[model samples]
Target chain A: MGEQLRKTPYHDLHVRNGGKMVPFAGWSMPVQFRNGILHEHRKVRGSAGVFDVSHMGRIYFRGPGAVAFVNYLITNNLERIGRGRLLYGALCNHDGGIIDDVTVYHLGDEILMVVNAANADAVWKWASELKPGDVEMVDATSDLAQIALQGPQAESCLAAPFDAAVKDVGYYGYAHVSWEGAQILISRNGYTGEDGFEIYVPTQLAVPLWETLFRWGSAAQLEPVGLGARDSLRMEVNYALYGNELNTDVSPLEAGLRWVVKLKKGDFVGREALLAQKKAGLRRTLVGFEVAGKRLPRHGHPIRSGAEEIGVVTSGGYCPSLDRGMGMGFVPPELAEIGTPLAIDARGALLEAKVVERPFYRKGSVKR
Target chain B: MEFPERLRYTKEHEWVRVEGDEVVFGITDFAQDQLGDIVYIELPEPGASLQRMDAFGSVEAVKTVTDLYAPVSCEVVAVNEALTDDPARVNNSPYGDGWMVRAKLGDAAQLDELLSAEAYQKLVAELGG
Candidate 1:
């Protein structure tokens, strides 16, 4: 396979623990463990699970004008965010299309932006061009590694290695903790829509911290999960993925993420286009659909109304928790209402479906 | 992977067993493991005619969809309707209840082209599964 690509700190450990390895985002990552996807996914929903997210990109912007430069690039209002707080926002292009959905952290004078691994280079280049005189943009992706501890028992599991104060870290808020003489950034945010902590540390020190957490949190029923479970977990909560749900051709407003776009926060990239589109009304909108039968619609499947094809499915899979097939796709704005009957043409056969609310399953520990 | 010694195998990972002139077909354990959790299976009609190595149907797992190929030249005689409601049977019992179809053999000579269990096991091992 193309030299097998780069590996994370737990690569060897994953293989030893019966993990099925697959190439994802140019990295050799685990797809599933010995317990399988269903067991691992339910484990995270009921208890806690650790994930190796080292492939995610970490970019740092420093200097005096870092805040101003970032404000001009992203669609969210950074002035409202305080230090140690995380903001879920989107980086859009000049045409109002989403470049990438990211989490921005205000780290005092500097800003730390976490992006999807597959869109790292694209986001870096886009942000680099916006860097003016004072701001210095550095791609700190290779210098750092990230791990996520997610589920209902996440807080107690993380409290062992860190401090009891880690429990008080509010949702979307983060704190810098000193573990094994290394300063790691721990944020109470995750894509699984569960109460979790995404910890960022130096690349070399990742293995030690992983081992410590796995060893100490073993009693808490924390299993080392892989990407297969991760995808199902996020899909269960209807979280958007980079290539599947969001892309350069789809705008944040069209994807139902208008809450992240702050039009009143002065001028920013894609602001005018978004404002104009908001005034004119959106032509197409993304909606969640549940397959009415046993047949599951796949990505690139044609969505139809009667016999006329209208849209295409962007992401689809069988939701284990929901015990049905679920997917996200962009249909005509008139047909975007909840409970709208739709059909997905799976090859030559038509599978009955209905457009429901965003999340297909909602019994997660996200707010807890 | 568990390759039953009495079963015949295809290069595409389909397994078949001949009972009189009728043959039962399903994916092997190696195929099921590689596909992850199977969510759906689209089977052909009972009266459909199949050619050797032709697409008979498809199996949908969580992240992938694999096209099922006919193991031998035969006329489809029966389809396992149990898979319509419970596709997970493919993961639970790939060789038994998960059998996709039963077909009456048109050419018995086509059965000899399939791999023996020992040969199939060696092929799976060589493929790094």
Candidate 2:
């Protein structure tokens, strides 16, 4: 709208590779390439695909109080996250509703938080406003560009250019490495529910590094993926997208992220509210649905139990892996059973669907 | 954005080809490209009556869902049921196997109001080269 706003470091590279650029998270990002989203999505599921996730926000909390500050801000138990380890967590409002879902990296004395790009400024401001003594919050989002190489062949593909030791980096773990004279943080973490590494390097070095990865990973069948594939991949895994499954109104507990909320971890921002909710029990929780018919349920589509509206779809799409219409949405706890029948009000028509378990396609290398 | 010279197009990007009274209908190549991947398509039921420019079906991609509009009023005689399992055919062959529906046109005069290949190309170009 406003001249289409900003572009990532790989903007020109995307265009050259026949990527269709679209506005997302306030940045111009490639949605798909010449082969299309289905091809890109299958590429990641079958072999390997590299995604330019540079639009995600990266913030560094440094100094002696870094650990304490992060422990106080997020709901996850930071003390349990050892050095070089990463933990998925959430920044919550006082009401226990999520401000943003984030991944925290315990980098020794410092803590690095990666948040949704759209919530970058909001997260930074919230953390700064809470500015407890001795902690320094720095917005490192612009300085870094993230590349995610995900799939079964991800390790072998990334190991070529990166340190051979990277192969041993366990899931949700990271290691600092020197690549082409630049410091890079390589994390064995991804949202695609696959074995992969999220490499964070200097923005100026993004294009060259991307090219090197593509060239070396070619034999491994690593393709340059776009955001469209990334979304479908995550959706298939039932990972919550910020605006979709998570928003100002949805709590981590309601979104099936209760494992991330540490009730025993002394104190945190939203501890009191979550503790209260835990006692009262969740009214509506996120659940997966697979449409029985060809009609796909979409965001804002109402979920019904006969004549009553039980819930609404937060994220829905046709999963290429399953060859079915799948979605994640909030539903009454009573209707969240694995095989419960539900109807999706897709516009004026009612589409038949059934509740299903999370990670709809589980033949992934996520834990492997 | 290939609009075949022999085909007539709608503003919503559907292409209709006349073969006697039966008209073959499919989305234009431009529509397929813009939609990215066709993951699911809800085709109109056989013998269903449709109005000109009305939504006859819908297509779902990974991130978005779009309604497929009728180019002209007709009765759906056939639907591509193969799309239920392999909807990517729309991307692979929008004009051939990806043809969505075959309908008997209610009025052949409506074809005159559709866009020509040159006109559709010009419209797409003006929207953005």
Candidate 3:
């Protein structure tokens, strides 16, 4: 093999199912299946789709200082989120630049920090190096695999195979359910802007779960979606992707994630800089734009206002749900208002685009 | 998708078929397979002239955007209007209905440098789609 890439537990299954494997964050992950991204994206929005998100770091934090140390590290209010609740927020450096966006699973006795696959190692190093007294974190990635069953029919699809107790878990809530004779953590939340469940199980049980899901989910037309759809789906909902929307150079506030920043929650990492930026007002703001036609406003393409370069596109592509090309980019606050006319440098040519309201597609089963 | 022996191909995985004086061109099956799903394709207007190997248009798949290169110097004669609405035809029918652009030959001699079907197959095999 040409420089062995790390494989997830479902790697063999993915290949057998015609997943187009691509090198992502050093892992041989499937970008799209044979059915393609548009199909996969539409499937998830219309019904249910499964995703193998096992590459994400499932680092466990336990001990007396677990809550305190995590509280100090993250931007969200971790102390109040008792057990079985999920807190979505970013971990920033002292400079307020977002290091990684993660979902903290509060399990009362312990906490599970689910981080981005690509940023897992660096995040682990960063957290491990600055670890305060008493708290400890262990990388549970190799031992665990995460599977998300997302869409409108997610609950019904999961209700048959998993325990009935799982039905009680509300949005952003989790339950320890007996799945295939194994106690697996199932969370009633997902990234696809759908009402779904994220099942975290032992690595060995991953394949069985995937198999059982496909078998049981077939009635609801559940498809095994890949990252291509995962990306477009998230983009349609305007969920901030780590490398594209959030990065080390950009603060969470600048990326329209100011709601997650807890300045009054006491001294956390990047509080000082965030406070300063808040006082000075954001210079550049991340905004959503709709391309006038089929031309894609690709990443790093310049955002323009009458020949003046205002900002740059971070993520852009065709959104199947919206049936149009759309993208997210940063522009001056003055130029970031909704319906403002904008031009994007799509490859060498200037394409007509305009700032639009967030979430190119809004008919999602997210809150349902 | 069958690669007609009469047609010619480029190393970039584009196929060309001569229709009298004008020529029709499109991405090959291998290119569509590699591209996954073509969501948007931007082609130049009719009557635009291009140099051999010059980038004429761009194709956007859900995963990436790739430039469509001119296999030979030619003037654009027509583009597939159907593709403007449903570009997935590029994936479903990479050879027939998915044809992207037609151009009058700028230098018909350039066809001599194009690869034969067998050679194109060998090139594809070496690249390993």
The numbered model that scores best in TM-score is 3
Lowest summed-lDDT stretch of 10 residues in model 2 chain A? A156-165
Predicted structure with the largest DockQ when compared to the true one: 3
Candidate 1: residue A292 lDDT (0-100): 78
Q: Write the per-residue lDDT of candidate 3 for residues A153-232, one digit (tens) a residue.
A: 88888777654777788888888977667889988888888889898999889898888888888789788899989999
Candidate 3 residue A104 C-alpha distance from true site, Å: 0.4
After superposing candidate 3, which stretches have Cα over 4 Å from the reference?
none
For every candidate, give the share of true A-B contacts it also has.
0.56, 0.94, 0.88
Q: In candidate 1, list every pair of residues with a backbone clash.
A: none
- Over 4 Å off, model 2: B80-86
Question: Each model's interface RMSD (Å)?
Answer: 1.4, 1.6, 1.0
Clashing pairs in 3: none
TM-score of each: 0.94, 0.95, 0.96
Ranking by DockQ, best first? 3, 2, 1
Clashing residue pairs, candidate 2? Answer: none
The sequence of per-residue lDDT tens digits that candidate 1 reaches over residues A1-368 is 55667788778988998899998888889999987888888889888999999888899999999988888888999998889788988999999998999989999899999998888889989988878889998888888889999988888887676766687799989999887788999999998978999999898898888888888788776888999989988887878888887999999998878889999999999999999999999989989999877678788999999989999998888888888898989998999999999999988879899999877787788873
